[model samples]
Target: MFYRIPSLGGLSPFVSLLSLALLAHNIDAASSGVINYGGDVPIGSKLVQVHVIYRHGDRNPKSPYPKSHYHDLKSWPGGWGELTDTGILQQIKLGILLKALYGPQNYGLLPEEFNVKIYKSVTTDVDRTIMSLIANQAGLWRSLKGKGIHEPDVQWNPTPFRVIADNKYDTIFGQNCSKAEKLVDMFRDERFEQLKNENLQLFQYAQENSGYEIMTHPTQICWLYDTLTVELLRKGIIPEWANALYPEPLESFLMEYLKAGSLTEEMRRLTGGPLLKTIITAMKNLTMGKDTIKMYAYSAHETSIYDVLAALCSPPKKPPGYTATLLFELFQYQNSFFLRILYRPGPDQTAFPMKIPGCGEQYICSLKKFEEITQHVLPKDLVAECTV
Candidate 1:
């Protein structure tokens, strides 16, 4: 007998294992969860557009410890902060699945299987994100070239795409938040400008390691940097930046800042100012693009996801995964255009209860345009186990 426990952040190894086993068991099309293309989905409805976001897949997390804590990559099996062999396989499998779902025949393309307007992107942080995209692209490129369908393809195409985010999402947010808060606190301590000398190392670290260029724009300096300083002043955490009321607890402050849900009002006050402007522009672009575009894809991070969602005025919740793409598919009915949202965890894999607003049905597969077919094919047993 199998038992279930509350999954850690909705993903548990036991659940993953059980779901895979159940999925394998119900691969036959006749099964309940099996997707029989002709029967379930209406034949005439075709997919016209698509958008996706996903995590970079499994990789070693950056910084397993606080500044005061000491540990090294050698402590782990594969050395510090690197993708495992299994992570490589995960990307490869994702590519193969993408090819199967959006093959030449499905997309009605000419050059090959992946001969569509596909824009690929990655972060320059480490080899993991780049390699994962490379492996995934390999499957698509090979499938399009008709090279090694049954076996692996060694050939590669020379194509470059947009890949951003050199700094990990958490790292960027954490550093910026900490610095902002610390700066504000220093101002209130009456130490004014003295705290800058005290935490010189932190400022240097932020410059060297934070992966963002220090802005010289006076507004940004105050908006992004000094606003944080101002918040610190309000908190009375620091003594006016020149003199220290107490020793700057940089290590302790940074440690607490990096953890999930650690972003507080102070951090939000600083970060939110810039994001509000960005969100407005993004929303405007989407609205204008909606007139002609059917699907939109944003190759962004969890912070981006949170930004967009919060822009839409969503409640505070975690955005999962690196490649987690948010899809906004506009459904055109007789006289109205309704927006349908899809959240993809990976290639052709989605969470349960996918419903397109106008479709009137859940788990609809025929409308493959902007849909992850993997979910419709997942058996009930698999779904049950997956939810564990």
Candidate 2:
């Protein structure tokens, strides 16, 4: 069910799951203005606006578990939780990809010059995220040399990114929400306990290898797995103690742990509400011809991307990879407007259009339908609900 498109340089763009039959023959046909991915686009559709939410790229482990034996923990160049040079490069590549997709001569969705009125970027006020945004912007506009205004050697343009205040409920990551905390406390219940008990052997194996007593809590275990996984990738060597640990079951448990908050309708509404509301409002503003901004970018965490995916009724197939992106695109066809959801699994992958369950096939739906189907999960009042 996946389709592959050859890149301009003859490299194969990553495979996408959108049906090949839905693609257009003329990718750059100006009349329709459809931004085709390997010739895939809804017939007669013209690209209008795009909103992207993405996780920061590769980074040093955020923290080590108590009594941890992670060897590289003390040697990471940026220390713990900060972006590494590799992380910057990952995001830079992503920015280059974005330029190819949306820059003026390509999709014509964004202007060549840096215009504050046409683009807005937002990021969680974290060092990694802010640095990622900077690196991404460098690649996004790498080709544009500002109208001979700056020094002749300058190849970069400033793309303003607003950093959301820390400790605010506006972003769920790294924030303290009492209600969300209370709801998440359900992991301590008997049901989750049974789930943990079923995986006791795996937990013990992880503990033995990690040099730490593995906590039975879902998030705690998930954190351990995530930290270790990244470390393994970075080090390119698996320790002898980890030989007995099976990766699949541990990953499943970690996914379950991460998704625990969105397992129920009420929890989904509470955890993902504010972000959903922001996206909906932006969509509304675009459709009404009131918003001039062509692209809105958010640099955030994996949890933020996952929660938004769950809110859209499209839980991610796996944890979002480094620089994983979720794009909400608004397309205009004559007098009608349609919305398409696309996901890029990583900086190296092609973006696949995603199906919004119950909305429609082809992964494209009427704007009204998009709103209707998503309304139930959108929080009516985030502050009031977050405290409940």
Candidate 3:
């Protein structure tokens, strides 16, 4: 839906996906201290906190396949797989929109002045994710900083983003489930065997054009799809032979493989449960006012979104796109707290409210109800749970 414009450096960025409806929006300021954002909010309730999880903006493909058209570095400004100038603009616009939708002068949801003590940001130590946090902060505050922070020439604020040094075994990402991995492995192997025979012709076609020495694994073909997709997103460099297979049988096959593990209760618990537990803990912290943070923004990957969604019993309908986001908000009404969730379908769209399954038909769920519904997937001991 979008293409990159390198010459503008994002000021007049190419009509990319992130700019569609977002750039033209002029959100009306809030009359009171509540942020409605087109959602039906109980009149007396006030937003207490928001927890955000978002994928990094558009970037070049990570894998460099054999005889690939995008092998040239000129096409990738920041080198392969790194966030591009286009992506930076996407994130900047996102921050601007977020501030407009939440800042005190606009929606009156967050504080007027920047308060470090009341906000927190974190990211995996990946280069793209870290850069996204910085770029997003630039838009969210627009050079507004603390009392003593300053720069000699640039109008900039230094926002501290804590980075997780190593997430290889982080339960919050649902990465430590050995049993779940084996189950998913078995499922994919079986599916792959059936698919291999069914799509022998496609396999032959990909083998000839995909550059992989072997087209045996489903993930390998998905990698080809990813490459072409990024190329199409950036410079439209995909060869005709490659384009023929993309976004079709390729995408359908990829989804089946990717979703195989998350289909079952035991799989979702061990594979996606840990992240849900982490979010539930944050909700509890806000309920107790234990942490002063009014918002916590996490710059992460698509898998993080999947973990939260699948564990919440709201598995995604498609691969989460670039800059796709999930927001978990807590509200206070008459001394009781409630939870509301929203999902942005794409970078250019406003997030629609989500009706979490088992939370009934309403968008808002009592904190107690929210906890009760998510309890099954929230593993008390991820390690022991993974032993299954």
Candidate 4:
């Protein structure tokens, strides 16, 4: 017998061991609760356009911890935070998956041929993300170019994608807010107490070894976690304490820090609300025929993923892994439009349709109801909200 537990996207988050054993043996397309990646269309609803936000692939640590051992720039050939070879491959894999799922033959969300007029992509002004987009495009083009298809003789052409400027604010990036800064300070103090009381030995060890500088901000330890994780990935040298307590309490602490940085209503408004506002505006524009683009893709960070999900009332339980994606699909049905949001946890994982809280158990939400339920999370005037 199989039991189900509540989870996002209508799939049970937890399953009994017997359920797992059953799932392992009886894998088929017809199984209830099983979502076929290519078969998620809502009844009688025709797909309209798709919007995607994905974290960059694996990379070296953006910054080293205090008294860090992995300081050599040569150690990371791509320099600080640049995409590694594995990162490129990861994005390429994602691109191929995108083509399989959204290309003309499947969901028909994207054009068969690469068309600047119908497709749009945006990324932050960062090297890893920029390269990841190019890599993903390469994967898509490769799929289009090979195997008894059109454009076999055509060499891969460059795809146009915009990059947000440093001083400007966009849907995926947060604007400056004194309130957010102060919240970070508050989170730092809170984490210090929690650590000192709960894991004092581990806390004191990481603190003394990593240096005091990293403890200045609540999110700084995440950098240290990054460094450690990269080393663990490479099978490089790591401290004994880290080997014992590295990913368990350390990862949890890092997640808490990330979540705490945007814990309050005002903090979420400044950090995550802009993206929701943008998405809503896009949906409204599509419903009104103002938007001609068929696909909108944002190549961004895990924080970007977190920002948007938190805005949607589903803050991530763990850090979004490399190539994690949030897909928002709009559909038209009988002169009305509805929405379907799915989360692909990793590059290789199947996309799970997210059943948004208060949006009911149904996977498809009408655009009008979506705008109504999401009003509390979408900021009215983002700039004004950020100021003072």
Specify the highest-lDDT model's number: 3
Off by over 4 Å in 3: 1-39, 72-74, 145-153, 167-169, 176-182, 383-388
Cα distance off (Å), candidate 1, residue 366: 20
Candidate 4 has a TM-score of 0.82
Scored by lDDT, model 4 comes in at 0.69
Model 4 worst lDDT run, 10 consecutive residues:
14-23
* Index of the highest-TM-score prediction: 3
Estimate every model's Cα lDDT from 0 to 1.
Answer: 0.36, 0.68, 0.72, 0.69
Writing each residue's lDDT as its tens digit, candidate 3 over 1-388 gives 1223334334333223223323323444233212236555698898888888888888878876677876777767777779986677777766766676778755466664557987788887788898888777666665444543443334445677787654335666556467777898888878877887888888878878877753566557777777888878877557878767878877787777767767777777776677667777887887887877877888888777876787777777888888888888888989898988888755765577787789776788988898898888777777676775
Candidate 3 displacement at residue 179 in angstroms? 4.4
Instruction: Between candidates 1 and 4, name the one with more favorable lDDT.
Output: 4
TM-scores for every candidate against the unseen true structure: 0.43, 0.83, 0.85, 0.82
lDDT for model 3, please: 0.72
Ranking by lDDT: 3, 4, 2, 1
Error of 1 at 333 (Å): 5.2
lDDT by residue (tens digit), candidate 4, 325-351? 988888898998888888877655566
The TM-score of candidate 2 is 0.83
List RMSD in Å for every model shown.
16.3, 7.5, 4.8, 9.6
lDDT of 2 by residue, 252-365 (tens): 766776687687787777766667777778878888988988888888888788888887778887888889988888888887887788887765666777877877555788
